[model samples]
Target chain A: MPFKDFSKGLVKANPLFVLVLGLCPALAVSTSIENAFGMGLAVIFVLVLSNLIISLLRNMIPKDVRIPCFIVIIATLVTIINITFKAYLPSLTESLGVYLPLITVNCIILGRAEAFASKNPPLRSVLDGVGEGIGFLLAMLLISFIRELLGSGGLNFTILGYKLGEFTIPVFSSMPALFFIMPTGAFLIIGLLLGLFKKTGVLR
Target chain B: MKENVKRVVVLTIIILVSSLSLYAYYTSTEDLIREQETAKLTEEINQIFPDAGRFVQKEDIYYVYSDDGDLIGYAFKATGKGYGGDISILVGVNNDEDLTIRKISVLSQSETPGLGTRITEDEFISQFNNKPIDAIKLRSNNGEIDAITGATISSNAVVNAVYTEYKNKIKSIQR
Candidate 1:
């Protein structure tokens, strides 16, 4: 129904690049492809659900207390997600650790709730949520694909007792650069990609 | 005054609905999460005591038994302040006078990525197998265990946790 509204979030108003929001999880969890996608899925779940709820309640909430109301709703959704992940995906639960719960504070969710969902209709808000989520997901996957490939020298599809497969470069696996897997690597790669995007007119 | 009352009523209703939903979900899944935690602990315990037939736990100690019902040894957990956060160590000891560590595994840690997380790697955790209490310290402290490079704090945290907890646990078990 809101098809036009959804597509813009995928690139133009992309949260990670043009908006430069939600950088904390983008950087912290982008060490591996597995974490990146895993984090992305969790964000999408929260984003879509929270956006829909906030849109429905938009008319009822007073401007003075709107921020606190959004916080409450977002925090509740994140807690539900946190417990669900812990129960169903214990391995991911461990690897993700604190960042999973820290999703409660992710600015992207709060930002969308206030800026878009509060002003938009329910269907349109849901579109924005999906578009933004996919955009964020694509950005994270790109950053981590490069990080894991260059840093760890491979991409892992391993998830809760399931390994689709892995491809590795033997020499790199044995003596990897190791920088891309570190905290500093996140900054360096994101910086380079951001610059490239700007230079190539992918971002302006 | 009328507007303020309406705002309070609406916010209260929203909170009540949110909490009720959470409670409903929690009641449904609490048992499943508990079972998962138990299964994980059992798996970790089995890895520590290879020949263990069945284990009985009391006050945080797991009493391991052989297939024929002989006491193989005991295992317990230890905690230390790590670089990232608290590090939990599972210590398996043989039924010997010295209670030398039969093996050890880093149960949980929040250490830094790449460098510190390597402590969970087989190369690092395997070093503690069959080492005496005295050998639990790092090589720098004149013990056998080598600290993982760039993660000395995490390595030392694991070492000190097992060493201290083992000493205290063994003393109490003997008494």
Candidate 2:
């Protein structure tokens, strides 16, 4: 019942800042806040479900074929999430596009299943999954906030009939930094954030 | 020897169960996915051809009509290979008498983000409005449209898809 297992992922072993797992989606979907939110939720669903299933079946699986088994389990969860998201949240689905289904190949789920989940009980594994997922989400939101704000000079909280009034920066909106919206901006933001965290003794 | 067989059995059961469950989920959601897809296409069509009160399919073209049943315009999908993947565009033209470009909307595309994706922006797509279909080429290529800077391939891919499809559809309709 130790709570350290859940909180550990937030900072000490964050999936992005500290551990740097799931870097692909973290960068690819971090261009916009809404996309980051969608990608984060999808990862959480896949991670928690895969971790739970893997922990439950850990003892039953053969050591030699466990990798393929883990992949199947994660892929199945991703596909179901993909379909449901496409149906219920079509805008988020479209915005995230290829990154949504790409969750199947994301190393985060597989890495957790193999490293932490398989060795732990189902409840602990679920907590780790949730923790790591949240850690990834925090990193994504920070990165996306900088990227979207600087790149577009605004943030649109409205997504799929939901409106949270768009906020526009006075001067930034006129000439937003186009560099911050490109692929390279993703790297710069993450690198600077990681450096700042290290300077503040968060990653050390 | 017995251990080997047990290992094989466990793996087989896992695979069988996974496939069966995924198949069931697929079957259940297949219809809903199609419905969502149709709804998205209809929404996009309504956006491009705002006057479209109804749509009728004639061959490969979508004939749009007003509430009074007069033809408002026509729309059809055109796809071309782009840098990342196929770019599908919904190309709309005025009614048969006016086979000029009305509006062009990027229906689906997987082009490079930020760069090629600019193809979907208003500054890029809005250029197609009221232009002759024949003039939908890059300015560098001696046409009226300007290719999105740093995204010429994607811009050209869209222009080419629209041009090719427009020609083919026009020829068929004229015949």
Q: TM-score winner among the candidates?
A: 1
lDDT of 1 by residue, B17-83 (tens): 8899999988888998999898898888889997888888877788888989998899999999999
Q: Which stretches of candidate 1 lie over 4 Å from their true place?
A: A159-161, B111-114, B149-151
Model 1, A112-180: lDDT tens per residue? 999999999999999999999998999999999888888877778765447888999887786667788
lDDT of 2 by residue, B32-114 (tens): 88899888878888998887788877797888888889987888899999987899899988874558899999977877655
* Candidate 2 TM-score to native: 0.89
lDDT of 2 by residue, A1-204 (tens): 647778887889898988778889988889878888878888988999999999999999888888988988888898889888877787778778889889998988888999999999999999999999998888888899899899888987754447767898997686678688778988999899888988998665
Model 2: DockQ against the native? 0.52
Runs with alpha carbons beyond 4 Å of true place in candidate 2: A158-161, B68-71, B80-86, B109-124, B138-142, B146-157
TM-score of chain B of 2: 0.83
Which window of ten consecutive residues has the lowest lDDT sum in model 1 chain A? A152-161
Clashes (N, CA, C under 3 Å) per candidate = 0, 0
